[model samples]
Structures are given as structure tokens and as C-alpha cells.
Target: MNASLKLLPLAIGAALAVLPAAYAAQDNVQTLSNFKTTGNTKPAETVPQTGTRADALRENLKAIKLPPGFKIELYAVVPEARAMTIEPSTGVVFVGTRKDRVWQVTDRTKRRVADDVVQFASSVTFKVPNAVCFSPDGVLYIVEQNRVLAFPAAQFFGEGGPDVAAAVVVPQGKLIPTQFESFNHGARYCRVGPDKKLYIALGQPWNVPPKDKLAELDKNGLAGIIRMDQNGKNREVYAHGVRNSVGLDFNPKDKSLWFTDNQVDGMGDDIPPGELNHATKAGANYGFPWYGGGHVRTEEYKDQTPPAGVVFPMVEYAAHAADLGMSFYTGKMFPEKYQGGIFDAEHGSWNRTKPIGARIMFTPVKDDGSVGETEVFAEGWLTPNGEYMGRPVDVQQLQDGSLLVSDDYAGAIYRISYAK
Candidate 1:
């Protein structure tokens, strides 16, 4: 048997022998690793187009299979909203768009409505704004292909319209530049860590590269989490070898950071699975091209072995799920069973022979922040014949204990709630 394959039976036996023990360990550590990135190329810029396709599709959202007395609703009309963030004080929601604009949606009268949609920020030439987030103090941070900009929360949404030109420039180092021909992941997602520092997700430039050329790998070198102070200073690598992580969230109770990574495509349908990881410490390397899921080896990283102290994912989802944004439920609106569960939006898949992952998934989370088995939360977005209605991109928990889901393909945001 091959040396790598030898590790599998052992790992599997270990997993099965002490499954409960493994769960105990997971509850304690709350981390995992090793994955790749996958996404469609950024769309080209075009004039703003209006539509009711998203509105029409909202009626089709299916109910999650849950206990009785729980209900979910279509919350708001946010066209083309993805990578969402909510301002705690005002309950105002902000989302980035593929049209190079950021939109703010407000909740009123138990309904979410677009109070005022403005071109909050713009990319000179890029097709989309990568991500957006609000700091604890209410500062709005927006990430473009090659730049990071911030505006005061109160000032941006105050009586006067936001002065986009007056926003503070955040130094993004060599990661983003004005002109770049190649080697840019450009899927920058950010969140505030337990330590109050900003953690940004930077993707690998290539899925799998030639083994001899390690430097090319470094271009995506900051493939994992990049930590920086609020001012974007003291930047350092929090972890390494992550391909691309679009969905990231910090557990409010344990203060641990969690993320969802889309694995590399073109691999056979079931060779490797999508991963859910936790950022445990600074400088930890999760196996990437080198190692995956404890024993799965890739051609590009054959000789390399998983380094000591490297972590693996807490749980694995179906291959080609295209898992994206993740958020932990910490609200009182839902049953206590869902208080700490994770809601992840699977953007669906393009590289698979069979369509998968067009809906949101739920994973039971322990008090210590480790995840349990994953179950389907919502479905029916994909037709039985494999045609897709919408692709979910992100999920966020609202101040009022509701959930917001962003669907980039249909350009709509749907709200999931529970009620007696």
C-alpha cells in the first residue's frame, strides 16, 4: 500500500474508534484546515439593470425542516446583495454588489426595505466589490479588487449622503495594486477577531501549480487569513495554505473564527470535499495543495507531508458545494437548539456533472464552538432537472434575531425567521 494510503485506514480507524473523543477534542480546539478556492471570473461592468426576477423567485424559497412552531420569511428586497454586514445600533444592513456598488437596506415595520440604495463605493475598473464589514465602533470597511477603504459609520449614513471621496485609505500592502495582470485572488472577506483585530481572507492565485515553483505559490502566499490592526498596520499571516475562503464568521460565545472554503475544481466529483475551518492561532498551516482531509493527497503536493501542528477541517461538506459565507446564530428568536448553530450559504457549483449546493445548510455547533454534523436547512432553489433559480452567497444574523441570506445570481436577499 502507498505510504499516504496507509495513513487513511489509521486515520479512519482513529476517527471511528474515538468518535466521541474526537468530538470532545474538537469542542476544545475549535479549528480545522487544508483546502482550495473556486469561483467564476468577475463579471464585466455594465449599466444598472432593474428586474423583478428576484422578487418573483422569493415566493419559491422552501421552509427548513425543523420542529413545529418555527417559520421563515422572505425578509427584504436587496438586489444583487452579497457579503453582508449589519450595523448593530441602527440595524441597518449593508451588502456589496457585483455592479461595483454597495447598498444599505433598512428594516422597518417588521419588514426589510431598501431605505436608500446608494453607490456607497465604486471600483474604477473592477467588476465587483469583493466584501464589506462594519467594525465594532460602526466604521464601514469596504474591500475592492486591489484596495480597502473605510468611512465613519455615523458620517456615511448621517443626514448628508456619504462622502465617498473623503473615506480613509487602508494600506493593503502588495496584495492589492492599481494595475495587476495576473496572480490576484481578489476574494477579500474581512471580520473582526476575538482580539479585536481585523482578519481578512485572501485567496490563492492558482488552484494547483507546478510543484517545482514554490514562489508562484507565494503569490497566493497569503492564501489564508491575514491579520492586521484596525488601521491596517502590523499585518501578519494568521494561517497559511488555504486556497480561498469566501465565508467567514467569529463565534460570539467562544470568540473563535470560522470559515468555509471551496475546494479546487476539475478534480473528480468526489476526490475531495469542501471544508469548514477554524483559525486557532497565528502561523498555523492547514494542508493545502500538499495535504487534505488527513490523508487525501493531490498530484501537485505529492512529496510534501502535513506539517506538525497543522489542523484539519471540523466537518466536510459535499464536493462542489461552493460553500461561501457563514454566520453563528446567537439570537433569542430561534429555539435554543439553534442558538449556537452555524448557517452557511452554499453558492451551488458549476464544475460538477450533477448540480449541488444551491441552498443553505445548518451544522450543530457545540458550546465550545466546534461544529457537528451538517444538515440541510433550506432547499428547492435548484430545479429537479438541474436548472438553478438562485445561488446563496452569504448569511447574517440580524439584531432582531432574524437571518438574512444573500443570493447574488438572482440579485435578492431573503430573510429566514422563526415564530410561534
Candidate 2:
């Protein structure tokens, strides 16, 4: 063996010895590495995952305000439910979470309600697998902090506990540069775009990335939505200057990209508004730290010149609403006015002095692709007294033309439909 080859085992041993200590020195206190599948999660032990608190759920659902003929009901109980995707062929709803597990919810009886809510790949290890999406051909892609995994023929996989095998498309360490990895804003949301590319949101670790690290961050696809071939090659940033966007969907009519951005905070109660943004062309720039939410500039970069052609938001919501997962309405069950509309989830506020969001909002999209007025579609998760009964995280349309909304706080998903 060559001299260098002879040193391989020693080097390997040294690296093995340094592994745990290196992990210990990592700075992100809430990093995904902290949550192991073994002992850390402490998943809730209860059926209907929301438990038997029927009265509270009923009251919360009752408090919801919707148009006539629209109603809301519990769909399933999924812990820390964040982003959602449905397998059209099998009618399986795959729910992601901010926890250690991904859930597979099935309506085995075709009752339009999920009677079986079970953990997906319960046998596999996962850390903050909060984003799940499906390809038109039934391939499932799961995005976690710093990793992307693919499960072929995912919708047909047997529904057994802790099951399913995943082929790593983007390994954990490869997605984010080591220097940019942090606990904050690491949960990724993904979808197979019209171009048949896998697109994912790679949130920056900070509310605003430091000036010194911006170049490295951008080069690594941090702080933006990135797209690549279905097999994860040729990763490229599609949008930039995005502080953090949890919700995004492609317009079916025109195949444009639209996303909701959670804006900068510490700007007082209502200075910067949360955003509903549209991306018309490739490599679009949505102003972030320079232009905090929509047009409001961040105090840190108040005087700096922003990018010349930064794209602004289509609509702005009240500041700190925590706008999250969204999907364009393609269902026919709702009124004709809602076809091709947008249904978005507001995950509610965490830092504001006055809490807001915690509801589902809708925006109408006209044939000309102009976004009409925005309105509250369903609420009651947060009460008049400011108590949070639930926090809506994502919105996905079911095969039946209804909608499924996920809530992390209440550990449940709700189905919304129209009767008239």
C-alpha cells in the first residue's frame, strides 16, 4: 500500500474520535441534530392525537367564521404539523412536522375523513422533517433541516409503523454549508415544480443574514427558494433576499411562482407587514433585510441601497402574522369565485406584543392573474382573549376539492369544505 493509504486508518480513527466532540461544540442550540429519533421526541400518547378534549375543539371550530355552506372538521391529529402534500393517485395525505416523525394519514374508508393517522417510516431516523411533497407520478420527497430525501412510489408503500426506505437525494451536510448551519429557519418546504424540478425553501439561519456572510450564504442557496433537477443536480437559487418564506405554490393557470413571506420583527408592533409575494421570472429577488417585508426597510439596512430590481409583495398582511404554507385553489367544490384562488395559513405570532394570525386567509386570482382582495377565510384558533387554541400551519387541497389545514399547536389537521 502507498504511504498515504497506510495513514488512512489513523485519520479515520481520529475523525471518529472527534465526531461527538465536534457536534458538542456546534452553536445552534435548537439544531435538528439535537432531536434524535430515540429518546428526545417524547411524542404525545393519545388517540385522535388531540386527545379527548372534545369540548375545546368543538368550541374552537364553532368560533371559526366562514362563508355560508363552508364548514370545518377535524381531519387528523398530527404533531407539530407544518407542511403538507397529498398523493393524488393513492389519495394518501403525507404530513410533515417540526418533530421527529412524519405522519401518513389515510381515509381507508373513503369517508372524506381520515380514520387512520400513523407515523411514516417509524423505523427510520428523522430530525425535523417538516416539509413533504409529491411528484405527479407519485414519488414523495421529504425535506428536513439540511437534507432532502426521496421515496419512490411513495404513495403505494405499505402503511406500517416506522416503515419505508428513503434514498438520500441531498445528504444532510451537503445541502447547507457548515458555516451557515444554524437552528433558526432551517425547516425546508419543497415541491415538484411545473418544470419537473424539485424546489425547496432554504431559510437563512438569522432573521437577516450578516453582511459578511451574505456571499457565502447566497452561493450555498441559503435565504432563498432553490430548484434543481428531479434527481437533485444543478441546484440553483430561484428567488433571493427572502428573510423566511414558509409557504409557496405554483399557479396552475399560468405556472407562475407565488410565496408568502414572514417579515422582519423588532420593528415594533405593526411596522412591517407579512407578505404574499409573486415571482414572475427566474432568479427573482424579493427584498429581505433591505426591504424587510414588502416595502418597509429594516432598521439595520435602512440607508443601504437595495437591489435595483427587487420584486415586492403582491399583498401584505398585518405584521407578525407568521404567514406559512399555501396552495392555489384548483378544486371545483367551492364557489366559482374561488377557482384558482389562493388559500394560505397564518401560523400566528411568536414575538409580537399582541398576537395575530392563527387563521386561514384567501386571495382571489383573476384570469388576468391579478390578485384581488385578501380576506379571512377561517379563524377561531385564536380567541378574543388571546388564548391560542390552535395555530394553522399549512393548507392543501384534497382530491375531493375540499381543503386540509394543519395546526402544530393543537396537533391536528382540519378539513374545510363547502356544502351548498
Candidate 3:
């Protein structure tokens, strides 16, 4: 045997020793075995796109206000839709839900409306597969609560059957320490960066984690964003101190990372504003626990001095807006003013005295790369009586320059297009 080849076992053992205990060899082996099954004959579960529920969603579009020449229409019905990614080759939109299912929405006739909405890879049992994104080469990545799976050539295999070919990128309970997992703040967001690395947001699981938990949370990336190779190797935390960021996108211009952060709750109705942050480099900390949101000191750490070099948000939104998913508009279908702007979804507030932000906000990027003032691009989801008609979760831009907004509250995706 070659001299270097003789050391392979030693190298493997060294690496395994450093990994967390949750990544046990036995558990990973079992998870891999489950993913490599032969094609499943079980039919994919299809979501009904028509009927009373669909009609009610379409009617709500009339209440939404958009700029002149812009219109919103129901695109598809995807239950608990949170994050979305489109296959570049086929225009197939894969949407992730807060539940165990990830949906594949297809428009077969090239029409704007979807012809089919079915669960993708139905046989694989997922846990909160709320983050779905695609690589430049059409590889599908499903980032779950504590696992990440990859599907190569997903555009083709997705239509084959319920058991589409899959490979475990990050095994169950391996993305973060299993003990730190919580029911709240678990929904994640991921994006394939310009360097072709996979980036995932790791929401720290608490309204405000106790002081004793902060070190562990940051070390395991449960309170920050992490990145790794597409095959889930060489993983490292990209940003630190994020409370819970469900929305993030790369600025098409300078390639800086921008994301929205939901701040701590129970701080009253109108304080500690939500955040739209800009991350220009790795290892950047966006203060949490110490500074709740937008430099507002948290009650838990108001007396202690926060770590130096904490980055503040570029834009501080209204308190309790619950800003979630966002995307930079790269399509030419919109007017010149919106050429390189952002469309952010505010899921709205759950506990505020008066609910706010069940609509889309547009922020323009100036020529010098500064973010312009954000303005409301769509509204009326919150009714005159303050009831939520539909709460938007994510925004995805189609190839034709139109945009798709996913709403978990309404269980549907709405398309927005502009024409003069």
C-alpha cells in the first residue's frame, strides 16, 4: 500500500473525535441508509389549487395596494410556505414549509399560475424543512431543523416519484447540538452563496437565552449563521450573534450578505426595533442577548458591557413587525427604479397591541451601494379591524422578472408583476 494511504484510518479517526457526539456513526449510517432507497412508487401528495380556499385567497389580492402598473395574483397554494428557491433550468419552484413537507410548484403550460403543487420527495420524513434553496447547477438543498439534505439533478428526479434520489449533507442532530434544540425559533433560512458554498441561518432557540447558554449557543452556531461546502464539509460559522434570521439574500451588486432579524419579545409593543442587517465579512457579530435589537439594550444584559465590534442594522424597522424573508430584485420586468432593490416580507406581529406588517416593503439600493429608505410596496393584509387576512413569509423572483411571495397564514404563494 502507498505510504500516505496507510495513514487513512488514523486521519478518519482524528476527524471523528472532534465532531459533536450527536454525529454518532451509527445514527449517520442509518440516516444515509434511509436516504439511498430505490425510487418509491407512492404518489406525491398534491395540494388543491382551486375551491373555496383558493377563491378566498384570490379575493384578498384585491385588497393589496401596489404601485401603479403592478399587480398581485395567486400563484399556488403551498401550506405553511416559508422559504423558496427556483430551478434555473425548469423554472420549477420548490417551496419549504414549517411542517415536514417541501412542496414542488410547477407551471407546465408556461402560464403564470401553477398547474401542479405536490410534495417533493414525499417518502423522506423531514422535521421542519423550512429552508429550500438551489445551487447554480440546479442542485436542491433542503435545510431542516437539524439536518441538511441535497438532491442533485432535482429538477428531473423530483418528477420521477416520491423517493427522489437524495444524499445526507448534514445528518440528523448534526447541524447543531441536539440538546439545545427548542420548539420556538426553529424555522431556518439558507442560500447558496456566490462562492458556491451553502449558507444557513441558525436561530438561537429562546426569547432571550439565559446568560449561561450564550457561549454554547454561539459555539454551536445555534445563535448565528453557518456555511459549508455543498457536500456539507468544512462547516464554519459565517456570522455570530443573530437572534433569529428567517430571511437573507446576497446583494447582486457587491455580494454582501443582508438579512432580517426578529428581535426579543415581551419588551412592550413599540421598542427594540426589528433589524435589516448588512454583513460585509465573516465573523461579524450582530449583538444579541446584550443588545436586543437596533442597539436597544436587553433587560437581561443592560448592565453588562457588550462585546466590542458588534455590528448594528442598516435599517431598523418598526418594533414587532416580525420581518422574515427577503430577496434582491434582479429581474428586468420591474421599472428602472426597482432594478436592484429589496422586497422584504413582514409576517406581522403576534403579541403587539396593534398588529403591524402583513405586507411587503421595498428598499432601493443606491448607486454607491447604500440602502435607500424603505417604503411599503404592498399592504392591506391587516384589515380595518386589525385582523390578519394573510401574512407573507418569503419573496422569490421568477426568471421573467416577476416576484412570488409565500404566505404561511394564507397557505398560498402570490405572484407580483409589473407592466406599463
Candidate 4:
């Protein structure tokens, strides 16, 4: 009687009858040069040789359990890093690379430390840069693919260093213009919000569904969440249907924003499940392609009934589980049940059929913030039969409280702590 609960009312009546014809054939907005950036054309590669299978990468990460002293470590390796940022005046730790490069580890003995790496910024033919924030005046924001550059913490610790060509700084309404074949979704993960505004996660030119006709079922043409003004002017639309949110954050207790989407593949290996939104206002739509997560909905927006203002998903993760970077631990050195919680990374799934998120999930937040059901704060890099070596993505927090994690599939950064 539980064959997956008898296919839940036929997947909720076929996602409410094709959500308004996928929003009346979306309204034309496809143009990001058709999403194509091979990200680093492959060349400088080395750093995936963990012996004894590296303790099986910690055996499915022991299903993570934490809460009694808290402890975890692997910390510094910096191979393909991914997305990360931390400067607090000089503990360093830049990181950003799908290959175009940008690193600067440091800590060379400031004590509560662990870095040494250094590349600073290089080549740049637009590999998957992703994101790398900073700007409390030290500058350093970057989010390649569609562009959004900046750099000047003395040009990334100068002495004639990190000048990927210097003179970089694109803050004039944050350049947004790519979308050719569809699915450019390249707003890439960005951050600087606490109202300092500069958020950005865009994704959705087309992972599927978009033959054009005003973008087929258009809800503003291709996914959402944009916000600007770190000089990028008042460009608004803080939330709306999102289909590739590469991890975003802001809940330092109510600053409220939180993100982590990444679902929408031939729709089969278990329907939909990768989301964790929570914008609240400023645009709020959260339904992507139609509707996903519990209320399900999305056969191209099935017969449209999910509107009353559009916004759903406070938690849901499993389907593709490619979550990506997100942080919000606040820190005290752990145990207080890992304060505030919400540390996502899951870069696992490659269009699924096995592999489910690369591991590191936490959830649990409520004092009015909501979300309260995820767990497995860390798990073996994949292999209950799937076989993956490392993926994780982003999750920072280290003024000493510990927790760094990057792992562009084993380029390494990990440093989760809690020790007695």
C-alpha cells in the first residue's frame, strides 16, 4: 500500500494540469548566447590522488551526526576550489574556479589557520568562475560568464600580484546579456546583501522547455532572483521561479534571503526535489517552470493554478540534489546544535539515475525562520553504488568557528570543525 504512496494523487493531478500552460507560453526573454562556456577548456589538472581511497572519503561521511563536541577536518587542498570568500581584514581564503582560476589562500600562521595556496587570478577565458564576494570596501566581487567583475584589496594582496589584467570593475547596472540557444541562466552565484544589495543567481535560459513563443509559458522569461545596487543601480526582481540558483545567503538572523536550487532534468528519476528558497518579498515567485516541491506542479505549469502571488519551497532536497553553496551557521564552535543551521553544498547528481548530491546538508532553523527537516551534515562523496569522489561546493564560516568546504569535484577545501 506504499508503492511510493501510490504515486501521490497522480503527482498532484499532473502538477495542477500543466500550470497555466506553463504560464501562457512564458513571455519571450531568451538571449544569453545560448549557454556555452566550457569552463577552462581543461589543462592544468592534478590533485585527485587520495590514497587508501582516502579512507573511502570517510565512509559516506559517517552519515554525519554531530552535536557532541563536533569535529571534522580535511581542510586545505585547494584544487579546483569553486565559490568561496573570506577576508575579515586578512585571514584570506579567496577561492573561485571552474578553471578560469582565482585563489589566494594565506593564513601562513595567523594561528586559527589553514591556507597557503595562491594563484590570485589568471587566464580568464570565462571558465565557470561562479562567485566570490567581499566588498566591505576591500572590494573583490566576481561572477563570470555574463560578467560582474571587481578586485582591489590592494589588487588582491599586491607586490605585483593578482592582476588578471587589472583595471577590472563592472558596476554600472551589472551587465546582463547572454542567451542565445537558451538556458544561459548565468547570473552565477553572487552576494553582498544585508541590504548592501548585490545579490544575483539568475539561471534558466533552458535546461529544457523553451522553444520560444515568448519563451513558452513565460513567467518573465527564464527563471529568477536578481537584485542589484552595489553600483549596479536599482535593478529589482528579488525572486521569481528560479531554476538554477547556485546557492545564495543572507539570513544572519532575519536578513532573510537563502537559496539553493538546481533541479529540472528530463523529469523522471523521481520528479523534482532540489530547492530551499525563502525570499519573502521584493518579487517572490519561487515556482520555476511551473511549480515544484510538495505541491509539485510543472508539466510546463500544468493548467496554471499556482499564482495567488507565487512562492513556495522552504525546504526540499533529493531529486537531483545538486544544491550548491549556502551558509548560515553563525558559529560558536558548534554544539548548541550547530547554531542556526543551514549549510548546504550537495554538488552531486549529473542528471541523475543514481548519484544524489555530493553531501553536506543541515537544515533546522526556527525561531520564526521556518525550515526544519534536513540532515546528513556530511556524507561520503558518493557511493552506496553511485561512485563519485568529491563534489561538495560552497559553505563558508570561519572567524575561527570552522567550516569551509569547496571541492570542485575534489579540488579540495574542506575544514569542518568542532573538537571537544
Q: Pick the candidate with the highest TM-score.
A: 3
lDDT of 4 by residue, 23-118 (tens): 212311011111122233333323332454444544534554445666565556676778888877775878887556677676667554453565
lDDT of 4 at 412: 68
lDDT of 2 at 2: 34
Candidates ranked, most accurate by TM-score first = 3, 2, 1, 4
The segments of candidate 3 whose C-alpha lies over 4 angstroms from its true place after superposition are 1-40
Cα error of candidate 1 at position 323, Å: 0.7
Off by over 4 Å in 1: 1-55, 62-68, 108-110, 122-127, 154-159, 176-184, 212-221, 292-294
Candidate 1, residues 118-161, lDDT tens digits: the string is: 44422222245668887776766676554555545533433233
Q: Candidates' TM-scores?
A: 0.80, 0.88, 0.92, 0.32
- Candidate 2 lDDT over 319-369, as tens digits, reads 999999999999999999889999999999988887998999999998887
Q: Residue by residue across 1-420, what tens digits does model 3's lDDT show?
A: 432224324433443444444643433422323345544466889999999999999998899999999999999988988899999988999999888889999999889999999888876778899999988867788999988877766767778777565566786778989887777988889999998899999997789999898888988887799999776778999999899999999998888899999998999999889999999999999999898899899999998888889999999999999999999999999998988998999999999999999989999987577888999999989998999999999999999999999999889999999989
Write down the lDDT of every candidate, Cα atoms only.
0.65, 0.78, 0.86, 0.64
- Backbone steric clashes in candidate 4, count: 44
Model 4's TM-score against the true structure: 0.32
lDDT ranking from best to worst?
3, 2, 1, 4
**Can you list the residue pairs that collide in candidate 2?**
121-162, 121-163, 122-162, 122-163, 123-162
